[model samples]
Target: MKNAIEISHLTKSYGKNRGVIDVTLNIKEGDIFGFLGPNGAGKSTTIRSILGFLKFDSGNIKVLGMDSVKDHVNILKNVGYMPSEAWFYNSMKVAEAIKYAADVRGLDCGEEAEKLCKRLKLDTNKRIKELSLGNRKKVSIVCAMQHKPKLFIFDEPTSGLDPLIQKKFFELINEYVSDGATCLLSTHVLSEVNKYCKNAAIMREGRLALLDSPDIDDDTFLKFYYDEEDL
Candidate 1:
């Protein structure tokens, strides 16, 4: 099968500190891949790089079969992204924000967006500033998934969600995966990875520490973090 996401020796530096260094991994088509790491471990850095938000100092990244740097706009058309932080124009209503996102993507997402809002119980009439953190996240989720893109990229997507809502979010993800969509879920939660991911990669200090199947037990999971790679 063709790879959905491929990275090789990806390095990005911020002066004295490294953003990501020599990180290499491949996410196969139709796979739910977990990008696991602790805070400041370059998980977001790698993600941002893949999304073409930040230019890396070296190495290469490919989305689907295209070079990420050169084909970012095209890549984005087929990808749904939920950033680590959700932000919107404070003055816009929830519905307005959703519409604006759809307009920018040049896709009509009215029906799916409305369905998602109802399922997540989001108040579309409320102004962005009036919503709680979790509610805002709900809006972001709808905007990201409305178009039914081929690939999904979620960064700490369930941060402020309540348990029930988190379950709903996972259900939506499962539905997407069931339809053969690929996903890259970046989070610190091990249970989330173990439950959803077919394969997983652990990042430490801007480098890849391990890449393996997610079917391992708790003891094996802990051991990967301690294992060192030559890269």
Candidate 2:
């Protein structure tokens, strides 16, 4: 088994503000890894660093056997990212937005986009500004999955989505993983972690609080969250 993502002694700070501190982790290819953390716990910070969107203070991050910074563009080509808050050109239609995402990867994703849109119940004819939060999330899902990238980095991906759509989304992810893709799922939904994740990590105060299987007991999590020393 190969590691799809590797981080060693990774640290990042936002001036005097807090960020991730000496975080280290590895996810094997084809694994569905869950990232759990309260708001402001640095889950997004660590993810941003992995995508080379933020400059870290020290340490190294490798994705797909390549340096995160030096191979940023190449890494992007194989990554399918769906942010919690998907941003789009308000003036463009949803179909156009998906096309723009496909263009960025230099791939023709028409067939996949259509399939995902149908499964997600997304309206391709709607303008970006006309869509609600859930609709926007659906658009993001289409954009991310259309190209069928090797790796998925989803940050709070299920937010704003209805129960049916959320179920469909996970089904699609399962299909992707079965095809040998890897995923990094960052979210606050513990139920999802328990159901879909093989391995999980929790963060607190910009530091790792626990690293274990997703089937963590409630008491154990409560103890760990109250104070890292308790764990």
Candidate 3:
């Protein structure tokens, strides 16, 4: 299968602090690739680099056959991204924020957005700042999915969502994947990964500790990683 994302010899640092080191991975087109790691393990760093948000010390990153830095504008047009942090104009209502995102993405999916809002049980009239963390997350998901981009990149996507909502989110993801969309998901939620991801990369200390298909249960996967002290 053709690759949707490719990283080779990727390295990044924050002055003296290492963000990522010699990271390399390939995600096939139409694959749900899970990126798993403990805190500070460079998952977000790598994602940002791939999105051209942060400059790396050295490496190559390509998305959809285009260099990330040089082709960022074009790449972004075909990509849908949801960051780890959900940011919005504090005073804007949820519906307004979703509209703003849709406008920016050149999407006119008011009906789809409304359906998602109803399905997620999100109150569209509440100001962003007034919403709880989970509500904010729901808004982000709605915005990201409304555009229907070919590639979806989500960082810690389910952090503040309830279990029921999380399940709904996964179902939505599967729906997208079934339509031949690709995803690169970074999260600490092993259960979600086990359920949705076909392949996963486990990162530790800015490097890959393991990369494998989801052939084992989450508990066994956790035990395997725990047994490996350095990871």
Highest lDDT against the true fold, candidate: 2
* lDDT of model 1 at position 168: 98
- Model 1 misplaced regions, further than 4 Å: 216-231
TM-score of 1: 0.93
Q: Give one digit per residue, the lDDT tens place, for model 3 in 185-214.
A: 998888778889999988877887556576
lDDT per residue (tens digit) for residues 1-231 in model 1: 889999999999988887988999888888889988767889999999999989889999999898998899999998999987899999999999999999999989999999999999999999999988899999999988999988999999999999999999999999998898899999877899989888898887788866657766776666545536632
The whole-model C-alpha lDDT of candidate 3 against the native structure comes to 0.88
Stretches of candidate 2 off by over 4 Å are: 224-231
**Each candidate's clash count:** 0, 0, 0
TM-score to true structure, per model: 0.93, 0.96, 0.92
Which window of 10 residues has the lowest lDDT sum in candidate 2?
A: 222-231
Output the number of the TM-score-best candidate: 2
Ranking by lDDT: 2, 1, 3
Root-mean-square deviation (CA) per prediction: 2.8, 1.7, 2.1
Candidate 3 ranges beyond 4 A from true positions:
217-231
Q: CA lDDT of each candidate?
A: 0.89, 0.92, 0.88
